[model samples]
Target: MLRTAAAAILGVTVLASASMAQDYRLNPIYQTISLRGGFTPDPYVINLQSGGNNDASRTLGGSCRGWVATAPDVRLHFQAGSLPLIISANSSTDTTLVVNGPDGRWYCNDDGGNGLNPSLRWNSPMSGQYDIWIGTYGSSRNANAQLHISELYSQ
Candidate 1:
């Protein structure tokens, strides 16, 4: 009887250990934002809109009409930490959004002609601040854009 009880206790301990190990694995966290542009050059700053550290910064993806004569860009200011692995965007026009990281830049192209949902993945560097931009050569008047962010880390 004593040996049987010990064996049962050991089995229960092994099962509990396996369950704890699985529970400790990191899970991905996601955040989303919606942007609406006006007739005027209403550059939506993701950091400002999301309220700073709570959200990431954003820039024009590439060059717009007269504003931001260069590629549309979005600037982000981080808290000097690693970022998520996945970033996505959706718009009503063929647009490209680029994420400028501390190490390099990764881009997501949207060529749906009308608009599309696009996503890009990359390893973000640790930084105090970062910038991301989106834009197209043609004119996108009063366009709507959506941004999605996914972060994965072990607590």
Candidate 2:
């Protein structure tokens, strides 16, 4: 009986961890965009809803604030050059940004953009895939937000 109970507990713990794991390999919740340095559109914009059930600090760690979904919000395939790369989010409610860079590093920011938005800038960014997640501060409630990808300046 003791062995059976321990097995059941272990099974439940494994299942829960698997569900909370964030998989960048999976298709993003929004859309995937391929952009090269100096792409025609200066700032590529995508409208999305922010916040999720997963706790960013718990899942991502290292000052990763806010709540985000299990899957990425957007995936960006960037070809780098001389120019810089900027990712920002704009919303009425406070929002946060979490990115898994191509270099296999986690970058996060909160209120680094205009007003209560979040932004991240990479000078001389590497050329590869960037998985992005937009989150809401304080709570798990979703909020309307616009994600801006630009090489120029943040919005």
Candidate 3:
């Protein structure tokens, strides 16, 4: 009887360990293109016509807008490519960038040059379509920038 009880307890421990393990896998690739015309008048620009020197770090120094889709319990991988063009923003107000989602409402805010980048990662809290809005404004106006993006869906 003692031996049988010990064996039963060992089996239960093994089963519990297996159930507690977490599994992470790569999801399929989803991608799209986004652009901002240099000639268009952007309300987010702080200095419309001021052509200032381009920052070498090229880090987003001003506010810009964009969106991403969301789904309950879903993780997404965002990859961005190099941008060769010059982009700028004004100093008066934060640049306005809007991110539109399918189920959820739009997300708009001033990003003091924090949005410009090679890539970004986002997770979905509610499943639905999403879009990113780029606000053009500030002394960074007329500055050109280009970037390619890739998204990997993961659960």
Q: lDDT for every model?
A: 0.30, 0.79, 0.26
For model 3, how does the per-residue alpha-carbon lDDT over 47-95 read when each residue is reduced to its tens digit? Answer: 1221222321122222223221121112222222232111222233333
lDDT of 2 at 129: 97
Residue 77 error for model 3, in Å? 13
Off by over 4 Å in 1: 1-73, 79-83, 104-108, 111-115, 123-128, 137-142, 152-155
lDDT per residue (tens digit) for residues 50-79 in model 1: 111111112322221111112223444443
RMSD of each: 20.4, 13.2, 21.5
TM-score of each: 0.38, 0.85, 0.27
lDDT of 3 at 56: 12
Q: Per-residue alpha-carbon lDDT of model 2 for 46-146, expressed as tens digits?
A: 99999988887788665677889889999999999797788889899999888888877777778767767777777768999998999999899999999
Pick the winner on TM-score between candidates 1 and 2: 2
What value does the lDDT take at residue 3 in candidate 3?
A: 22
lDDT of 3 at 50: 16
